[model samples]
Target: MTPRTPAPGSVTEATCTRCQILKPAAAFYANPLTRKGLHSRCIECMKDVGALRREVPKTTAAEATCNVCGWLKPSSEFHVNRRRFNGLTNRCRACAQDYYQAKRRGIIEYQRQHRWEDARVRMASDARRRDRKHGRESDIKAKDIVIPRACPVTGKPIYHGYGVRMAWSPCLERIDKSKGFVKGNWRVVSWEAVEASGWQLTRT
Candidate 1:
């Protein structure tokens, strides 16, 4: 007797209205407005139509050319951009991801290089480092250090974050050479002030 049911891939196959390629019905998107309840074109062909309608070459109308890689790939490989005529970004998703990652790294580096560190934090860290270098570790924390707007010793304005120490840059120094980072013995002063007062600099 003849088989009662049709074999798979023989029936229920869909032909994309735009690409005109025969594909499985599962390839199309559900569309309540259509009689067949599915989009006329397959998912890829629907994306390709968006690019082709933007005045791209007809020969490659079914695919979009990545502006970065210059490779012709299915439009699905690109990210959507409502501002663009083609509704897709110039670069494919892979290339776009790489570009964004690099951009994020640059932004982080710029922030690190340009943003000011807290004056108290800088002084406190330097004190700890100096103490360690001289075999004299202290219990001083970052909060224990206080940085004033102007140097008390020389009465000069202190500046921060020009990427390097300036004459007006703040410096952490001991009020007495015999005391090393002792509570109430250390003060923030301008680099120039430290020089004028003949104070011993914190040796590395």
Candidate 2:
């Protein structure tokens, strides 16, 4: 027997053989070959087909090209992208790195030659700003603070200088050698008030 056709604008109900559920004609695809009119597969099957379509590869041979080198390569060589072009960078990665390094070196050389005076001025300004931030009393205390130490290598008096310190010491080896005496073969003698020490030369 031939299936009955629903009137125009009327709803026709069909059962999905796979899902075993009855739905309206809107829920199934139109099957031109089947007189029943509605597709055997249901909405769930259509959704699965859509998902598979999204997962399928869409790249073609003509799509793969490097923007920098203008070289035509395979899709594997290029970087991947979800929205736009994918595959490796247009210029090879090595060329990109070298370009950046050269630019950096040029900047360093320029700064080295021109920045010394500017750096000194900046340092002085920073010191003054730090002093102002800490207050004048802190600056005075720092200036007056004496570091109690002679030279670490030679036990000699350290003198205070303008915002700095200095150390003074005589080289015993040099003094002995100047007097025609070996460094290790020097004799120790005490000079009394009545006896004058061997012609001593004070360091000017």
Candidate 3:
């Protein structure tokens, strides 16, 4: 893979493929495979990369940083989150649990104050995100979600309850599970009805 000899009065400089910067031929490592007989990256760029690799501990290179504890921990300690570049959550499991509980309290209070009609305000983003994650089509919005006074399946009153008493709690159901939350494709039903229908809690 010998490079052709440079012509007389040939250019003495070439651009780095990595940094896209023009530098002297001496600034690059020899590469017989390339037409210019030089490496793709400049010597300085290669050195910087090698230095960074040396600085990071090999055993902890795949570890993630916890947003709450400000500590580097094993990536397994973080929940899987497709939204992040690293495919893991920013906070550790303990911190994420605490944050979820706090957010749940706020959501419950808001729903209570709004008589549950405003549950859509909190779920609109979740619906949109779920559609994108599952690669489904949807045009649903916060205003499109309407909570009924009674469950469509069980004909029971709709209200929130704790633990096993959540049977009567109102939950959204997609008539076509393969499809997204589009208009006329979903309804409000009781959790008990969902259980009887062989369905589990979703869109949460």
> Candidates' TM-scores?
0.49, 0.25, 0.39
Q: Pick the candidate with the highest lDDT.
A: 3
* lDDT tens digits by residue: candidate 3, 52-169: 6556332323678998999989887987765455767789999989999999999988768675545666556667787898898878887788777788777888875343447887
- The residue-by-residue lDDT of candidate 2 on 1-204, one tens digit each, is 233355586548888887788987777776767767767877777678667656634553335566667777665565555434342356444446677899999998787544433433443344345445544211222222223334333344433222321223111111332332222322222112102333233110
| True-structure lDDT of candidate 3 | 0.74
Candidate 1 Cα misplacement greater than 4 A, ranges: 1-49, 52-119, 135-137, 199-204
Q: What's the CA error at residue 1 for candidate 3, in Å? A: 94
Q: lDDT of each model, Cα atoms only? A: 0.72, 0.46, 0.74
User: Candidates 2 and 3: which is better by TM-score?
Assistant: 3
What residue pairs are clashing in model 3?
A: none
**CA shift at 40, candidate 3, in angstroms?**
89
- Measured by TM-score, how close is model 3 to the native structure? 0.39
Better of 1 and 2 by lDDT: 1
Put down candidate 1 lDDT per residue, 59-154, tens digits, no spaces.
Answer: 323457899999989978987675566667789999999999999999987775444356667777878878877876466667776567788877
